[model samples]
Target: MSGVREPAGAYDPVDALLQRAHRLGADPRNTNYAGGNASAKGTATDPVTGGDVELMWVKGSGGDLGTLTAAGLAVLRLDRLRALAGTYPGVDREDEMVAAFDHCLHGKGWLPGGEGTAPSIDTAMHGLVGAPHVDHLHPDSGIALACAADGEELTRRCFGERVVWVPWRRPGFQLGLDIAAVYEAHPGAIGVVLGGHGITAWGKDSAECERNSLEIIRTAERFLAEQGRPDPFGPLVEGYGPLPAPERRERAAALAPVIRGLASADRPQVGHFTDADAVLDFLAREAHPRLAALGTSCPDHFLRTKVRPLVLDLPPDAPLDEAVARLRELHAAYREDYRAYYERHADAGSPPMRGADPAIVLVPGVGMFSFGKDKQTARVAGEFYVNAVNVMRGAEAVSSYAPIPEAEKFRIEYWELEEAKLRRMPPPKPLATRVALVTGAGSGIGRAIARRLVAEGACVVVADRDADAAEAVAAGLGGPDRALAAVVDVTDEEQIAAAFRAAVRAFGGVDLVVNNAGISVSKPLAETTAADWDTQHAIMARGSFLVSREAARVLAAQGMGGDIVYIASKNGVFAGPNNIAYGAAKADQAHQVRLLAAELGGLGVRVNGVNPDGVVRGSGIFAGGWGAQRAAVYGVPEEKLGEFYAQRTLLKREVLPEHVANAVFALTAGELSHTTGLHIPVDAGVAAAFLR
Candidate 1:
């Protein structure tokens, strides 16, 4: 079939620019979530004259290029941007340039919602260029050349006279002018390499711009290949190596809690491990100590990876306790050194900088660890450093790895424009740093409890036997960053262990676990089959036991106090007909809570239980046609069953899953800090089930 043809005059420059931005931004080797920017020149008909008017479409400040949209591209008058360049003097002119760009917006910089969007910091340079399309990216391959000691000479040899080379200048009005002048001198150049920064390419269209950028990167890769030196990590590709020994892995797991404790301040932090061959190779190098101390391959990574990673000297024979003590001492020293570096570079004009704590940590026998407020941020930082390892290795393969000088590094790290991006975020929630796991979270009380926990700012693991249901619940709570779905049969010991491991891999470690998974079978004592009894006991009794056991192990190893809550039924305490099997299993679970509380209290772990009754709405147990069947046994309509239970309660109100969730939160949130092994009745005042 022939392609459908569009009407004449249908070319869209904004769409073209967005497509290219996403293409480049999606590549981790090129740009991370918000690393790069792009711009394009286009024309629109003037409302009054019906004449073509030039417009500049630049990527908005603080927006992700991977998901660029028309709203994310700030439209400005080309003439205004060019004119704004003359308003700023040469030195420290970023603020003035920003103001001018803000004023140059199409209609007082107003967007659809009446708020204005700021253009990229490179808007001035993009406007000055003659080409219709322009892109600025921080590709690792190209950065390998830009950060090398002989970068300029190598770039010249690689591109010949096809590209311009601009010396390092902190990005602002002055740099834009410098870029324009360099381009003017080499009018035929396809792109320019900004020494110690990144690369910028331009063309008449988006495709041409992207093609030129990739070609420049490919050229750098070929030039490095011609150098004939072995990979810096030897034969290793990107510094990966074989996994560490089993004993070493165990030690790393044991040491994670100690590292997390040392790194935390007012709030706790999470720690994630990486045994990727690239990371292992970097740690194994003889010059690892000296090479690792050097600054990051690019300035954009300074905020996430820090100027330098912390290197711990851990001996193979040292005990875990001694390792913890040594780490504590070294962490204190690391902060002191960071303060010294700041003092050496601080100016009277700039605001006081926060102490530089280590984001990446290297342990020789254990591999690498990255720390963050939560798992997602930790993973992003880790990925960047992993790329940094490759870039440094690439540079060393061609020549010695030489980063920008300390003064420039300080300037970039402390730049107010870059720092503003972080300041724009709202304050974190109270439970923001905590991670939780809720079993049976695909529906009912478990799902309600998981939602409440996340709303209060905890990362959650939604575990259930139903994988699709669990995934749906996780998606509803938020994306994978906030909640992970784990298919787990809690009665299976191996599956329970694997779920905890997956939780740790997803979000560092777990601080709270809610054992809310259970099954119910209604039948007279004599009529109940052996299979029916075993099924209820398998989930309600044995499953709760296994989950609690695993939780204690992880919480104790973390060296931090945590909460484990079991969801028992009111029938556990108050005997009821036709509920013998379920009631017995729940009674076992309730007693297990008390025993666990007694044993784990010494390890700083808390164990508790919530006994809920008649919460039929949105409950999986009541669904699948079981509600009608159970209601018939009680001689009440299914619709009236909830009211029937409510009338029997002292409070005369229907109990809800949310009420049970609130009780769970109360016990786990430290409101009842001094209490443990306690069961809070959540049946809207069912006095029969009250603690005697």
Candidate 2:
């Protein structure tokens, strides 16, 4: 609560505040990502006044503390911020205070030019605290004690008056004023436990502020650890035990697509599945139904997980098909209830109901399935729920877990400030929520296609027979949220099925599939071997069919329209010499596209093909000696084969791997939605391969 004097030439307060934030945020026990704010007051030469002025730099809205940067700080003039209190509006009109923050912004070099990062709702809590440094965090341990029914009494016992208790109030200008009043009244108080929220602490210096924050978190953590009851969630209900690891994963994979379909009614959604110990323990317990319906207490927590998750009526070990059938009914009921909840509390000012679908779904024995417009959001939602579970357990250990009332939840959920934040977000890309699975994506055309899909905002499954190559492509595409590598031999049905399952688990389900795996063997009839003919057919024709079959099954399960494109070759149509086995395999692939297109039309699955000429540059097949064999037959040097092929084409252009990739993207990226069973040639106007 006390601090040392500011030394001469001390480090910038802004830099020191960021270091403090990072130190506190490094531990999950201190705060969740982007859930808290830290601030420091320092003197800066004002650009307008040309004199020293006190400026407060606080973590701006919507930034994680651990990764907080200077740009994320909202620099504000303290004198102006304090002046707003004289013109303060009542609680009902407090939302207007956010707009007023603009007048107090210290910009024109202090922050990014023009308008800077918008201030968070809790900005007043930091500015009005009358301390040189302040922190507000939502650690699970603190939230547990805050949500307890006897939180006021517990706070008194935990801190012995060093930390006071403030009653439940939704975060806003008025709540900030309330905390400032508490800080002024209790000169001995270093922090206060916010009822149904988190904790806040302040100090005379940055170091003291960080120490106070951690002490509060650690003390409450120890209080709960020692006094908390064993099995705080109560004993597991009979017949609701967790399934084996293999079975849990299998069930989650089987149901992820179905849940994704229900959740994506408004827009496409990516999913994340978790069967961690906390989730399983909570799901199997008797208290979950009561606590889950009560929902999370913290504002940041519910903003992600929603007020309540949709819990399954059937147990996890129930008959698989029956459970799935019942799940559809459960989801429908959940939507109806959510719509009613919005109607009950919404007035004219509430943001239009953002989607009635549940964000989190609990399957008793399997695990939890969370969905969002992108993979990162889904993963974060799941993580927040796990935190909620921990809070419930701890609260029940000491006292009953009581979250903020439903009306308050609705108010916060649709607050105009929150709605404004949503509106400020940029529009999604063309293929924003679409997920694509590209076979042979380890190198060549497949790699190009994978990278292209991800660039357009699609989550990609980089599938290939080469493990290292597949991993490299996936890594280049992005982090796990964007692309995941699947080592698969498409000719093997089990591995193909597993790859599709991996796609479903990683990003909900596949919406676009590229069957680009292939092999080539050019030889005259006299020299062609039976083994060569069978191998080509197995890798190209059979592999394409297997991957397509699995893709179709998932698409049907999801009831979402999807695309499958086969990367055939120009030789499929052209009667080129010494290209028997390779040409026959490509021809088989070309016909299969038509057959599947006809069959899958009713299911909203489009089937298409791309026939490309000899792609010599960066071609895995060409680099594997096919180029030398073709060059020998054409009586041209191996290095000059590309030029020779280009001269023979009407356009006289050498086809590269990217050209094949472009053709593949064209067939599936919605521009050709109405076109199917079609083969667009990537070859440079090869007259012999033109389709009638």
Candidate 3:
């Protein structure tokens, strides 16, 4: 108590303090109850017998730090400690239990004698120490270090021998005893690591305790700095060198099976890795350390194996057994090391655990591999470890980071507390998790189509001439698996091919392809240039062919029924002026959809097109306000153009992107499963002609 000081600045208001805790990632659900439980303090004799203790602010059993209520925080006792810890006295009451226990304790005169009842699980420890404030946390860094190869040694080096390190134990009462013993031995120890449990700090007041907790974490961070680390992963992909188109596709094909195998459980989704040279070069630079230092990333990921990556240097047609053997050799060593680590430190009487595997595989000239039970989980593993590699490589800048110990990791991995997170709702549907490749995604009808697919629970890969815009849209969607924005001039077959590859690599497989990319002109056919005609065909016609070609390859290979949608406009069906190039291209798309549907029907690939009427307004093909001017030129008032168009439709409403999206969804939903090569009108009833 020599360092004790007066309370500072009136505790900054409890609300302010709680907000700070949340900002620091404190689990609010575990910190506060619905009815406002503030403190945890009581004695052993009547552990639950404390009446003066107010609301029992126990961290809710399994609430996230972001959402918790005061009532959700339990109100329990401190004095009923002995009876609660005892054989439970064979009595479980519903309510007023704390009050009954308090009356008994009050009769014995050991109770604190107050109006309120109930205390927290940690009440005894909080009150016995006479500290005005206490805090506990399951910090990522601290837990990670606790599960490392040299947890105790690292702790000693980082925090000094004066710090306390308890062995892994079940939480609650057992933890309290372990802590009590440590405190008695090192009375002045300000911080405590409860092994598999968590970390704790106590101070004369709230501010001091908060400062101590943060400082302790800073100390842990310093420990991380002292340890040499590996490199972090670059973005999903890096720079693409000048590789031949065939060679790149071949490389992607080789990786397809392995990727698919990893994602097979969650459906046969595959990750297509590109920019091979960049990923290869990055790995080559770190071959020595990554191989020797094991691997990077967290412990619970051990099922995917430890940090060291599997480096593959086999031939293209190498036998599967041979490849698996090579993987086995790498994993055997990793598993052995993990076992030895546990053997050296684990108690003689702990339960056995399942062995871990190698989650990361680095193909010499290929990309990285992250294997998991599902595509989503596997990709997360792959990306996170890659990021760790970067962080480890930059350890010189941020300093080396150490992992927590294996035994501690095992305890938490199997901990009941952590297992409770599994009770939440599961993810969305797979087809609902559609993967759509949209051409000309940067602007116009293409962008609208992409947005529509995204709104329908599909992950869209937006390809456009403008790389920045594609990337912007991708970023806006959030997360790699949800959206991929790539720059590509649909006119170039190589970029088009690569764009499809990028989409597959990120989301597993492609479900829908919207050939919505096309260019338009206002010039009369007599004034059109050959170059303009060719460019239009390249994007609107040839571009559509290239994307569909790839989509067919993947869908056929997948054996799962899929859909191909082309965004053809009313120009394909009805005559329109100065639209020779666009009309011709759209007509080509329609013809191809019907022909391809015939050819690919046996393969379960349905091809269709949506012919929209007035979707041209914001399509960039028309100059600013050209739609209005066109209305006037066509002898219809500007305000009546929408009505003029809608009147022709059965729905009597202007066709929006939403209408187009709904049509696309219906086509792909297997509703039109038996229907293919059909042109669905998305322009309300525009095609229902009445010669007025």
Candidate with top lDDT is 2
Q: Count the backbone clashes (under 3 Å) in each candidate.
A: 5, 0, 54
Worst 10-residue stretch by lDDT in candidate 2? 1-10
lDDT of 1 by residue, 1-692 (tens): 00112246655677778788988888776676677689888776554576766778888887778888777777788887888666767665565677678777776432445444677677877888878888888777677777778888878987898877787877777777787787778778888888877788888888899898778777777877787377564543222233347765666666665666556643577667777777777776665677788968577666678788888765444677887777878888888888888888878865567545688887765667787777777777787788778778777877677877777878877777766766877887757778899999999999999999999888899999999999999999988778999999988998888788777756667889999997788888998899988998998898998898888877876777889999987888998878788889999999998999999999888889999987888888887565776798789999888888899899899888899999988887766888899988999888878888
Cα-lDDT of candidate 2: 0.89
Q: Rank candidates, TM-score, best first.
A: 2, 1, 3
User: Which of 1 and 3 is the better model by lDDT?
Assistant: 1
Question: Per-candidate TM vs. native?
Answer: 0.87, 0.97, 0.65
lDDT of 3 by residue, 90-173 (tens): 222212222333432233222134333233334434433334455665454455445444556656766775457776554444
Best by TM-score: 2
Write the candidate numbers in order of decreasing lDDT: 2, 1, 3
Q: What TM-score, to 2 decimals, does candidate 3 have?
A: 0.65
lDDT for model 1:
0.79
Q: Candidate 2: TM-score?
A: 0.97
